[model samples]
Structure formats: structure tokens, C-alpha cells
Target: MSSSTPNKVPSSPPASPFKLALCQTPVTLDKEENIAVARDYLMRAAAAGASLAVLPECFNCPYDTACFREYAEELPAVGFKPTEDHSSPSLKMLRQTAQETKMFIVGGSVPEIANDGNIYNSSLSVSPDGTVVAKHRKAHLFDIDVPGGIRFKESDVLSPGGSATAFFAPEIDCTVGVGICYDVRFPELAMLQARELGAKVLVFPGAFNMTTGPAHWELLLRGRALDNQVFVAACSPSRSEGGDGYTAWGHSMVVDPWGTVLASADEKPALVVTTIDLGRLDTVRKSIPTSQQRREDIYRLQSVP
Candidate 1:
């Protein structure tokens, strides 16, 4: 069996559709440099007519398991509040860029310091008006010893999110499901957003290593989209050499409801843009009706043996 379980599919129809942009870029040690790169890519996405742009996980810092302390920042206040002056400079730049672009931006996953001084890997969605629409803590920590000998104990420095987050995007005309890096490995979280929250577009900000990305990245993404009949998009941080002492397999992609890889970025700094047709989602759902064709009677609730 795979290390993680698959997400569940929703038993309903999509309310709407939207254009998406996937920003795939390399992270740099210099905070300002990284922001500049992200801003540039985001502009390209906006120019390409994407209503929303999603960034990669830890786009602001190295994805090293050990650098969480040096890079972590306190969650900004409710509004356009900036991270403290001494806080991560990347946070300030992201907030400012979102306001300027007038486009909804999902600031992939970042290291956030909670009020209680505990650190959590978190993601935030920013509206064009600069309001923080949704804040999602990563539910499934990337804690595993990969078969190739790579080990990631994300739980050591971060706390898991207690609930799923689904938010409305006026531009998309539908709700969105939020996820980060390793969270995509758990399909239950995706199902919670698609089935319970009625999200049509599932967004994930991820950084997978070459060890696993080549093996499971695309498989997992296509599986989720096929099962849920909803669009799946992921922004991935580009590989780097400095702090992480690790390399990321940056195959950022956008998959359609029919499990098609509509667009993808292959091992480079690039912008992936794709148009989502909501009507097609409904068409597929009607044909398959997997959500409604349930064997609920057979899979009845039962206690663990």
C-alpha cells in the first residue's frame, strides 16, 4: 500500500469554473530576490488572464526540515497587517504584491508562528482587495521515511491543522479547497473539501523530492481529480542547492476533472496557465455518477476490529 490514503470524491455538481495559474520557481536565499521572482511570475499569470494564481510551498525559504525556526514568522493580523519588521521579509512582499495585482493569490505554504509560540506550516489566500480570505494549516504533516532513505519529520516543528478550509472566489464563481505540500497525499482531506464544502477547484502548494515526485506526484494528482471530478492544481517550489541540502522535483501541474494533465511545468522556473470549463465537469459527473452510485449499505459504520 502507498504510505498515505487517497482522498474521497464528492457526490454532486460543480457550481462554477475559473482560470488558474501555477507558479513554479526556484527559491533563493536572498528574501527580496525570491519575492521579485514570484512577483514577476505572478504578473505573467495575471497577464495570461488567470483569475487566480497559486504559489509553491515555502516559496519564500528553503524547504529544509531544519530551517523552520529561522524562517518562521508570526501570523499577520487580520487585515493587511505586515509581519513584524524583524519578521521574514518574504511575508511582507507577498502581502504587498497581492494588493497591487488585483488578483486572488494563494500564498502557498509558509512557516507561521502561532500566538502560542508554536510553529505551524500554513497557507493563506488573499483576495484582490488585499483581505486574507482563508488560512489553512497543513493537516497532514510530511512525516515519513521514504523508501530511498529520505526522511521528513515535518511534525517536529509544525502543528497539524484541525479542520479543512473551503472558501468562495468571486472570480472563479465557485468555492476552492486549500492544501499544502504533503497534504495531497491524504485524499480524505480533499474529499472533505470537495464533498462537504462543495469546492470545485482543489489547490495544493507542494515540494516533492525527485525520489518520490517521479513515482507518485502525477499519479496522486490525477487520482484525486478523477475520483472527485474536480480540478486539481498544485504550485511547487523549484529545486535549490543552499540551505535545504535537498532537491525538489518541481513538476507543477494542473489536472482536469477527467484526470487529464491540462498543463504542467517541468523542472524549471515557469508559469503554467490553464482554463477550467465548469460545464465539462458537470458532463463527466453525469456520465459516471460515481458519487451517487454508492454502496453505503455494504460499507456500513463499524468499529475497528
Candidate 2:
């Protein structure tokens, strides 16, 4: 395999010991109510000294594929003329909440209406000053069917994002990569962010269901962290039994560079907090030197520009 770096690699990783809050909130039918609860959790996280707060996938709406189109709202285009009316209720609330809390907010995956009129499962990262720093549409759409288990085809209604996303988090003095739901299944995305973009953390806002959650949730989190020697965090919606739509597997967690579970939440509405130490990242990289010792002459991974 050949690997390519479409963007310039960072010279070094960012500073460490940043506090992160994973808000595993309940997702109700009422979008407004859900946003309200998310806002409350963000405030609580900030008050508790977290500089970064992450929400679960589809936090403002039901995770049913059928509901994506209904909940889809226009997102402000990057560098577009006269800023469009930030009329999308979800976007408005997220922006305002980030500003009010004075914390970086990873507004989790929302059904977004793109300029091309397509819907995408997208995540947005907002700065403490309420500016959108980065946006990542789920690159790997969740499309799976397990016999007598579960079936979900996000591709039926949503389009996959074209590029990997990583942006600097001034609050934490580090770079973070944003991914949604199924995007966590692809290790290349994490590798690109950690190895190429110098991202110290990868935040995935996913809603894995009963079938895959119990089987691979923790395993995947730890695997990614160990492989990249970076912090990996997954924020999931709280489980809801007997719900009409998808039943989320809620065990939101954060893993360290050494593949240790720093903090994890049970299958309930919770605000899981953890401190990510950049020093550990440096220690791991120095001890193993896996990233620098790669056999590029034998095999390589190519990045898509």
C-alpha cells in the first residue's frame, strides 16, 4: 500500500492536559428540547473546567434514517457572500451555546442541507468565540445489515463527506479531528489526522446501535488510540429502550494514547469528563517511534486531497 500526504504535515503536536467533556444526552423527539438539554450539559462542562465539549450523533433529532430529511437544515457555506441567514434552529442554538459557554463545542452530527441540496450527516466544531472552525461530513456512511440484528443505510438519504477534517483548537492548544458515527470504523481517517495533520485527539460523535455497540465500541476506541498514539473519544446518545426508532448503544468514552480508558459513561444520560495529556502522546511516540519508523518503501497510505 502507498501513503500520500495531501496537506503539509505539522512539525509537532500541540500542548497537553486539556479537559474534555463528552455529553451523552438523551435524544427525544422534540428537537428544541434536545438542543436545550445539550446546551445545559455544555454549560455544566464549562463550569466544571472543560475547555472542549462533545455531543452525540444526531443529538438534536431521532436517529432514524427516515427522519434525516425532515430534520435537515441549511448550513452556512464557507466563505460565501453576505452570510446567509443563520436560520437553522439547530445551528443557531449551537453557535449561541458555544459563545455563552466560552468553550469549544463539537456540535455533533446533524442532518445538514448542503448548497447542492443534498443531505449529509455532518459535525461542526465551534470555537470559544462562536466561530465555526471546522466541519466534517461523515465520510463513511453507516450502511449495514446484520441478520436478525439491525439494519441502517445512511447512504439512502445522506451523502458522504469528501475529505478528512482537522483543525486547531486554540483553547486546548492542540489540533483535533472531527468525525461522525461510522467514520470511526475507518482507521485511515484517524491515521491521516494523527500522523499527517498532527492531531492529538480524534472526536467521533456516533450512535452505534445494540448490534455493533456491545461488540466493537470500546474495542474500536482503544484500537484507534493505540494505533495512532493519540487520544480518541466517542460520544454516543443515551440508550432508549422501546423507542420507535433506533436504540442507541450508549457507553460514551475516552481513551488515552496508551489505549487506557480514561473515562466512560454507562448506558445513560451522562456528562463524561477526562483530561488528555499531550505529554503521554510524546512519551508513547518517543518510546515506540512507530510513526517515524514506518516502512514507506514497502507499503504506503495515500491521502485524498
Candidate 3:
């Protein structure tokens, strides 16, 4: 007999109709406290019967350039185990919690120190069995100057990631695409993930400021969902008096393929839970078949990788 274990068996994903949990918690400066709070929120989500859980970006450190270096830690190479030499309390917690809860976790984003010695804003997708399934570095850095409103440049310290992250989560029975904050602004990433990578749902662990949050947050989420004909979810840290005057918009939401807002939350630390129906996604696609109507003669989206 073959030596593959039960967990390694290649069986079809369990029948769908799963629940998703969005943890819109607060980000604190203390690394240990931040990790503890995240762990608690994840456990709470698991208790609520959610198979998939998402966290907000910068959930461990302040959203500031000066703090990235201090908070940055080496990460496990893609699917490998964490290195004992480096400090990775956040990653360890994610793995432990996923194993304990038997839930797939999209670990928002964290500051990472790569071998190149450059710090990157990165997100990890962990399987229910605590395996590091995928890693997504923020491809497009947030570099903007809104005149009198806000002037924050991520290019000042953080380096941009060069690849797209789309992976299948057998536990959740769906393919998920990950993007951090400003990566949502560029439609190419979303389209590529959903259209090319066969991602049924796209999750953006973003933190939009007051200026952009109220204006374009919902609009962008809805637009991406409608155009891609896929479920979309955005998780953000709650509004708080953060240091350096950085205020998050704090409205975490989940949208259906039909561009309908299924669930959303106000500017507070809350666990937003919603049930995502894969059956309805199929119904929506059948009702409006846009994928087959694309004109390859006129235009086409190619995947370099």
C-alpha cells in the first residue's frame, strides 16, 4: 500500500456553503500584546463556526515607516517550517491557531526581513492543518501624496514584491487571492487573480486612511467583485488614535459576486462574520455569463508566470 496519510489523500473538497470570519481588531505597538489580541480574535472566530478567517494589515506593529525595521522578522521560505534562529511569534501563533481550530487563515500582513536585507510588507495563507500554503508580498507599494490631505510614501522604506499570490485552500473548498491595501487600486491584480488564477474569492487585507476610505473603499470592492464575478472581502484595523497621526478607515466588509454587500461593520473593533455561498456564486455566473463573452480577438489578459 502507498504511504500517503489520510490528510494527504487527494479527494475532492468537501461540499460547499462555508462561513467566513473577518477580524477587524485594533493594532497595538506592543508586539506581544498585538499577537495575543490577534490570537484571541482568531479563536473567537473559530468558536463562531467559521472555516476561513482573515486579519487586517499591520496587525502587529504601528503603520509607520520608522517602526517597520524594528518589527520586521525573517519568514519561513514559502512552504517550510519557521526557522528557530529568527523570531516569528506572529507566524507561530497563526500556525498553532489554525491547527487548533482546523481553519484556514489569511494572515493579513506583516513586516518581513528577507535575505536581501530589505524589509517587505507580506501576507501568508495558512491551511487548516497549519501548513504555509502561500505567501503574498505587497506587489505595489503605497506611494502617494494627497496634497493637504495625506502624504505617506511606502517606497521610503519598504520594497515592492514582484509576484501575484493565488492558491487553492482544500479545507475551505475554494481558491483565494490575496492583496494588501494599495494593491487593490490596480485592477490588473484583481482581474489576474480571479480570471487567470481561477480564484473564486479575493481577500484584501487593507488599511485605508480617512481620505481614501470613505471615498473609494466600498466602490472599489464592489467594482472588483462585479467585474470579476467573484466574492470579495476586505479587512481593516479599527479606527483608533494611532501614533504619528495615522488613522485607519475601519469598515471591514464582504461582497458577493453580484456586487451586493452581504455584511459590513462600523469603525470599531468587531468580529464580522458572514456565510459565503459557493452555490450562489455559480447561480450568479449562470445568470450573467461574462467570462465566455470576452473578445479574445480584440484584447486578452496573459499570465507571465
lDDT of 1 by residue, 101-166 (tens): 777888887788888888888887777776667788888898889775587788888888766776
Candidate 3: tens digits of C-alpha lDDT, residues 155-183: 88899987777777776668888889999
As for TM-score, the candidate ahead, 1 or 3, is: 3
Whole-model alpha-carbon lDDT for candidate 1: 0.78
Model 1 ranges off by over 4 Å: 1-17, 77-91, 241-244, 300-305
Candidate 1, clashing residue pairs? Answer: 6-187, 7-187
Question: In terms of lDDT, which candidate is stronger, 2 or 3?
Answer: 3
Candidate 1 backbone clash number: 2
Candidate 2 lDDT over residue span 1-305, tens digit each: 11211234344564658789999999988889988998888888988889899999999899988889998888764322223447777777777877787888889888998878899988877777666777788888888999999988988998988888887776577788888878888998888887777788899999998999999999999999999999999999999998678999999999999999999999989999888887888898899889889999998877875
TM-score of each: 0.87, 0.93, 0.93
